[model samples]
Target: MKVTSHRDEIRVSRLLGASRYRVEKPFLSEGVIYGFFGATLGLLISFLLSLYFQGPLNRFFDPVKFIESDPFFYLSVAALEIIGGILVGYFSSWLSVRRFIKF
Candidate 1:
């Protein structure tokens, strides 16, 4: 009985005309671009969904109107919008990188 090494086996298989496939390297730029695009799309989708929900949400909590009428309303809304945008951007970017990156 003879023991065959892994390399030897591969060589023998190739010699016997076995079909083999080569793996290609992934491009960094392509992945980066894809992630950027996906993140943008995700953010837009999230914003739209938020808007749709906000209509009903405001009705349920009319206090929002009162809050809006307050002097600080503008500042508060601005802060919220900024925070929401950052959150959406980060979440979308993360998902895109994790799900679409070949690496």
Candidate 2:
């Protein structure tokens, strides 16, 4: 039942008039922003790599040019990944901070 430094900081913030929402919001928002940035970067790198390797891939597989021919499929997948990233980030941050803020 000993209060750790992390809990102390949360308690101090509450005592100093910061609302629970105010304290938790930043963590959630930061998680979301980071998730979005990470997902976008990952998607960009993957797309570029696929483009760069298209010739080798086509030569090896003979019918693997979906990247340029069916771009909407890739776009949909990218959208889903970004959305999933944002959701995971928000939930993880919320879960992590929920125990620290007593109120």
Candidate 3:
């Protein structure tokens, strides 16, 4: 059994291709930078839009009245802001990768 196992191992190693070399640290660093830039841009854009639209939005939905009350309003606004930022960041990252990383 041991002899067969060793033979099988040798055969498998011979059939398989050599291991790939590791990527350099610089490549990984550049990718991180690229992702960070996209996320930052998305967050900024989302924040500005949220700020500009918040007042009008609140006014339009004023009849509900609860949105303007207390911590609920603040919490809702914060959640919206966070969701907007995340969506923007994802899209921006996708665009950056698509545009810059050509096949």
Candidate 4:
């Protein structure tokens, strides 16, 4: 049995095709993943809120004001939220792996 040490990050990085990509790919991918999560989270919250409020607050859930007025509005909001989440993930990845790469 071959045992790999945690310090073998370099070897692992190279095995991933290249050292730079090892961190770059994860950072970018993590961002996209988190962004999708954020977008879904926003939509889910909106849905739940719509269901929770039945009286005057129900107006807040009107498709005329929120969903129908502009389809692009929802897309943009989701995109923005996704970007935000991705940025955070990217920053976190950078911070975590910055020290691991030597060249």
Lowest lDDT 10-mer window, candidate 2? Answer: 1-10
Worst 10 residues of 1 by lDDT: 21-30
- Model 2 lDDT per residue over 1-103, tens place: 1123457776778899998897788778978997898889989999899999988878998865454558788789999999988998888777777755557
Which pairs clash (backbone N, Cα, C closer than 3 Å) in model 4? none
Shift of residue 7 alpha carbon in model 4, Å: 4.6
Q: lDDT of candidate 4?
A: 0.63
The lDDT leader among the candidates is 2
lDDT of 1 by residue, 8-62 (tens): 6545655776644211112233444555565556667776898899878878987
Q: Worst lDDT window (10 residues) for model 3? A: 18-27
lDDT of candidate model 2 versus the reference: 0.79
For model 1, which pairs clash?
Answer: none
| Ranked candidates (TM-score, high to low) | 2, 4, 3, 1
Compared with the true structure, model 2 gives a TM-score of 0.78
List TM-score per model, in order: 0.38, 0.78, 0.42, 0.53
lDDT of 4 at 53: 75
lDDT comparing candidate 1 with the true structure: 0.51
**lDDT agreement with native, every candidate:** 0.51, 0.79, 0.53, 0.63
Winning candidate number (TM-score)? 2
What is residue 95's positional error in candidate 4, in angstroms? 2.4
